[model samples]
Target: MEYIDLYLIHWPMTVKPGKYEFPFPKDEIEPFDMKSVWEAMEECLRLGLTKAIGVSNFSSKKLHALLSTAQIPPSVNQVEVNPLWQQRKLRELCVAKGIQICAWSPLGARGALWGSDGVMECAVLMEIAEAKGKTLAQICLRWVYEQGDVVLVKSFNEKRMMENLDILGWELSDEDNHKISQIPQCKGYQGLDFVSPSGLTNPSWSFGMVRFDSIIVERERLQRTVGLIEPIVDSAVIPSGIVISSIYLKYKKMGRIPEVLLISAAPDSKPMPMIGFGTATYPFGPSEAARSAVVRAVAAGYRHFDTAAVYGSETSLGEAVADAVESGLVGSRDELFITSKLWCSDAHSDRVIPALRKTLQNLQMEYIDLYLIHWPIIRNFALDREIPPAVNQVEVNPLWQQKKLREFCVEKGIKICAYSPLGAKGTVWGNDRVMECEVLKEIAQAKGKTLAQICLRWVHEQGDCVLVKSYNDQRMKENLEIFDWELSEEDKYKINQIPQQRSVPAEDFISDVGPFKSLMELWDGEI
Candidate 1:
């Protein structure tokens, strides 16, 4: 071949140059020099021998070591992933680093000499397959697919290959995922076939072996000496996003669930919850904060999450979903709605798909429920493209009703989504007008509602989906209480009379040399 698309170091350790065989002599087994080997892989990419370079069977600890010194990081990490042996910790690291996970033994290598039928014989998987009218293998593949990992199944039979491909277009329910999570986890391959006794005991000899079972006790004893729990089994079973406290659950029970918007134009469109948790934090908080906040939101019964590439919260959102699924906070990521945007930097038609793929990677999800153009302008392309715009997300509140934009979207069969319903007070792009308005305060006081709730309920009453951001736990639950209430005619009249002024006027893009010269052009005079 002229060039290979992907080249990966199959295993971390280097054997003697003579013959390719397993269980080599102890002397022939040498420590895998990660830095030098990754550098060589980088050279392969530079010379066009391979389009991308990556690693296989790398542990989280080993990956951190390699990532520390490598000039070019691995693009993918091929590992063993099945419901029976879910590699949650390693997958978490891979997701965070933007490394694609290529599953090697998705079905536990069912028919191979070295493989087991554990995944195929999994009772939970068998039950799920039967209920879904699918084969056990299909259930396994679909589960891996749901995790947003690339499946590398080794199937030969034409009929079975067709069955494998049929795994798409259906999903495993939350109960199925929860049952699968409770299954006993055991590593199929313990690296015993490759490692010698000396390598097992010697600290420096087996840095390349990524399996947790073979090195956990020694590594933990040598590293920090914490014995609170079986680290591997504990982390593997409980998802990374699982909530330890009952605070979220308590708040969730207290809040009313938001109504959902059915977007018929979307592919396999799930109902987009009218009220969503906004992930863009002013002052740009840490990813941990985002992750924790999302978990809390999920616990508080918030289903829709609005994020963007520019927001830098996609990774945390993805992590939180994974944690929630694993922890049974939710049945699946499918239960929630995720909406992201096409940033202006990638607004062009050619870059749109790539930008979306990057967003999926950042979110650690296979598909986004709704994807929208973040801003009005595209670098070199018109806003009118082949893909029908399904939703128009804009700032909508008592202060800025956006009636013109809402009317236009209705005419075009597009859903109208409101953001900053409380005027995004305290943010640089927002104003205090909506929250501080006497008209809104009066309505809220009369109705025994919070000022923020009055604004959200008004937007909801207008039949617009609203996005509200609050990392605080109490406020997070309070945002969902709007669906149970309604605005009276007096309240509606007062809100309608409130002075209208757009809070976030795309001022950054309104420059002399840019596509938009004024707020009117930026918003097409809808402002």
Candidate 2:
């Protein structure tokens, strides 16, 4: 009892009746009953495996059945109870029966299941957190506990776990609780009756049918994020497809609204056309020349703005973005798709937030639409040529590097934008191993696509906002034409045959003075 504050049976090991299938369907087994599991929990409590024992993810009917059979009733029942799917009745029953309710996925689980709608991102919650100087998670947990239930928040990270437990001292006002309770319940998880014949027979059962209702609700919640921009009313503008129009008309349509604009440079607004001018950023130094170039691009109707802190051009870019907004070129900041990169120096887990703050300050923006790791190096390394080899060599990409950064960004709702995607200019394409590998080229030839297009397409497939840089307009247009053609399985297999090799040499910059050894180390992980 002293060893554990609480013990929870995560999920029923047995699949639903129709859902159960054993090893290639040859060794099928019947579904096991939760009554047996509850019996086991009773034994554990008697033996002192926990001070309090409970069942997680149990339905109301399941709980009642368990109660009817158990010698000792469960102290708690853990289940998903976010704003979208409040599980109010279950919570009320647990309260009435003297059973504590622990919310398992209070913030929603995977995107496919939860669809992002919840009290987690509610304006009221955010306002409360801002007033109290706490996080939304902290506020949500406090709400859960205030209702006389133990909140079962989980995180693999030690820091996050510790943060989850730090919500005890703060209390919410009665008014706050009432407002939170008033939030309309929306369903995030559907197909709860998976055992029903119709559900079992559906093909979507294999992948789980995501509740689109919740997705629409979540989109409505975040609609304010893009609310500032006015909608374009032209009958010619379609929601999705290649946008073929003068840069001015495209800007006039998209700039007035809170929507994504798919721009291309083709005369005919046909599908799969080339993009004339892709988003560009002048990294490495601050130059008025670069600002002028951006101004020119904006004047030519480019809606996407890309910048970074390490490049020192964010200040100028910010000024340009502000000017663009003020000049009516873009109706609001939300109308523009702004992307920036987090430098290698700021890739440390602890440094992520502060680094983003600095970027925001420099850019004079509230939030960035997308942020990328400039390079993929895991440890601090130098870029000086004169440094001796003994002092220069440092660890580069540790498998966990990009994964940690990506998780942090994903949780925060910041899009991950991959830059120098093929590894800096020389490193990715220059390597003999990479160049000699005929698979990518073969795929390109087979699909009548450029080798660079194959690389960009592969990166795009990974769910990142891909940034491909080119000085030549033709190359830029060719790079932008990627969305038109889909690479076949054979093409992907041919490209996969090529072995991994660093295009930019890490040894050239392994001095341990900056965030990365070289550009190669920055892109060590595949997208």
C-alpha TM-score for every candidate:
0.51, 0.37
Counting clashing residue pairs in each candidate, in order, gives: 2, 16
lDDT of each: 0.71, 0.51
lDDT of 1 by residue, 1-527 (tens): 99999999988777677997765675576545677788999999999999999999777777888888888999999988888667766776788899999998889987675577767776668878899888998999999999999998767789998888887798888778766654535555545344432234345434433223222122211111111111111222223343232111111124234334343544234445677888998666437988999998876777788898888888989999998766655545666789888888997879999999999999889998887778763211123434445677888888888787666555555667888898889898898888789988888888899999998888876767889989898898688777545788888887788778888776787889987898777776766
lDDT of 2 by residue, 289-354 (tens): 666555554444444566667668788778777776555444345445565667767868999999
Model 2 ranges off by over 4 Å = 1-283, 292-305, 323-329, 341-358, 370-417, 426-437, 508-527
TM-score of model 2 (CA atoms): 0.37
Worst 10 residues of 1 by lDDT: 220-229
Candidate 2 C-alpha error for residue 32, in Å: 56
lDDT of 2 at 239: 32
* Model 2 lDDT on a 0 to 1 scale: 0.51
